[model samples]
Target: MLVGSPKVRMPPGPRGPAALNTLRLVQRPVESMIGWRRRYGDIFTVRLLVFGTGVYVSDLDEIKAMFTGDQSSLRAGEANAPLAPVLGSRSVLILDGPEHLRQRRLLLPPFQGSAVERFREVIAEVAEAEVARWSVGDRFRMRDRMRELTFEVIVRAVFGVTDPARIERLRSALVAVIDSQAVLLVPGALRRDLGGVGPWAAFQRRKRAADALLYEEIEHRRRDDDLGERSDVLSLLLRARDEDGRPLSDAELRDELMTLLLAGHETTATSLAFAFDLLPRHPRVLARLRDELAGGGADYLGAVVSETMRIRPVLDAAERTLTEPRTVCGWDLPAGIRVYPAILAVQHRPDLYPEPGRFRPERFLAEDPPPYAWIPFGGGIRRCIGAALAQAEMAEVIRTVVERVDLEPVRPEPEPVVIRGITMVPRHGTPVRVARITG
Candidate 1:
């Protein structure tokens, strides 16, 4: 039989409905959670709105273990089951052990090292082309436009689809699926357990349509038997083989592609949107960023992207379950209780960072941050396979934006950020005015 409460008193945490607090945290994750950390200290557990369980950790040592723990002991799939229906049963993000390792290896070559260098021009050209389309005096929702631009870059660079007509159709369906996922974030068993069947069914129907297009391309390449075809993530996956020397199944191919498309596109777009939103508010930081860009080039902007991700980190926290009973940050967490290392909470701790709320790229410049202090792309075996590619993509776009157009924050209230399912985005789309510096 399970114990009612631990023999020792649990770490102090917010009183009242834990689930409601968690819901609010998702709505205003960073600010409110940081406040909790301030009041409750580093490690605390709050029972989320009935049936939901959560442990929030800002303590560095505990966080390191949470991220770097043995995979079997801290499974993410069990904790994130709500995403499976949308991401698909075989999605790499939901897999574990040898399976996760195999998929990641198959996916890594296209995202990092020399493979990334191959796509630099494509990313830059796409960014430049999109920038040209923006009229000088137009007021655009920066969040939506940034998503469009990054989504196009991801489509072109990863799938090699540069045709305007086909790309627009793909963008539409992908946006529908992502937008549906935004509604599923509210924490409750009713929505979480059921998978929002009505809208989710609609989302999957569109996803199937998108998959037909992706798989057609996959099959077209397979039929050619041309291993030396032009490079893209699709081709890389097509050619990658497991130790058994078997190619990925069609379902596996579709799931991984969907994973990349969803994960690679939206998260990067959110980070870029957040970076742009933060730029105009901190004039000194923005001016310094421009100076750094002028002198250091794209790498300078890359650092800014890293800092933006660290501060507002697109995902508020990554969760894992303890396989065995263990003491973490003082409390004895029993087997199967979930632990959430608050990336935003840890990053904003003034104890760890000086003036943590302020945007400063220099933090990522020289020294590596303390482990778990920065995990925008996550860590350990479950680390994001596309980290390097996302960085390069963000760097290229920022450079292009700065070079071609000057963005000014319009007179409007700043939007609060919120968690929608797994990805964090501005609650109200970021609004801005653009002026052409060079047409």
Candidate 2:
């Protein structure tokens, strides 16, 4: 059993000058986390301008306990308040306790089971169409292409919108809101809408325009008598009822839909971009993956996706704020302290993954990593609801690309990973050349 004095103050960490640590975090998150772990063991604290003196834990057992702890003891929603401007106050990402559960349940059906299976054809079709647009010898940023492809897929399959003009309009509005999100990283930028000029005002304007479109879509769905015939996520959400037999309010629907659209496409596209970047660098792995695809085997493809996420997770860590005082890794942390499960650090630990820097999909096929050791989508009840769809989308895209076209890195050296707002993406956006199409 674990042993430590309960009265000990919070774990050892950087007594930071705040701004420096925040800069390090934004600029070089993986390097900073790993460096801290080496100096302070598996758990440590770092203060940021927004979240003061937050504790970061890389120990797998502690991460498991914290994620599985009672809802009352940890508040993920409160910890994620910084995301409120983009996702809205009622989004599942920002709802706590019973409300989160209710919204999650209402949102779960469309991304699970048969509903997810039905999306496979749509994903493959989109991938094929997007891949067809690339010409041999063309050098392009794979992330940008993946973003366009994933955005188109989500806008059609998830939003239930098929009109070309309406899809383009939604896409433009979302891009404005997404592109302007870097302002949130400025610490106090989310506090209020200045409403006059500059980035904050621009963000508010973009958000208002996007929200107007979403609210209009929700209202239209509510009034549509043929909603039962639709297969999109919005349609499923529209049909959902709580135990009390109540449907979601228009605001609630807007929050959830916006949450899915933003979260679903961006992260998955980044992951795909990383996979494309990694695959060409390791020719043997690429050959094996292609062989697996040709043989109608999917296990290797799944492993590739798993390894990609494990190696280069988009989010550096999953964070939660303590709602009740608790002891973790022998340190007594008070309520309101933000605790982060260092996903990137833990996944890169040499003990958990031998030769941690190598891109080896076979590592996943050899043996499953321990429970919390492989948390690309996070853990416990608050795990990503779009996990299934994301995995399926990645797998389908990889298969389609490998089967149809031959791509190689534009340069022999790999591109560096850089932070884009909350996600880590290839610095040059994974530029690659389409050597040729096999068929």
Best by TM-score: 2
What does candidate 1's lDDT look like per residue over 236-267, in tens digits? 78888888898888888878877888888878
Worst 10 residues of 1 by lDDT: 187-196
Model 1 Cα shift for residue 301 (angstroms): 1.8
lDDT of 2 by residue, 115-183 (tens): 888889889988998989989999999999999999988988888887889999999998888777777
**Estimated TM-score per prediction?**
0.90, 0.92
Per-candidate Cα lDDT values, in order, are 0.76, 0.87
lDDT of 2 at 56: 85
For every candidate in turn, the CA RMSD to the true structure comes to 3.4, 3.4
Please give the TM-score that candidate 1 achieves against the real structure: 0.90
Clashes of each: 3, 0
Candidate 2 has its poorest 10 consecutive residues by lDDT at: 1-10
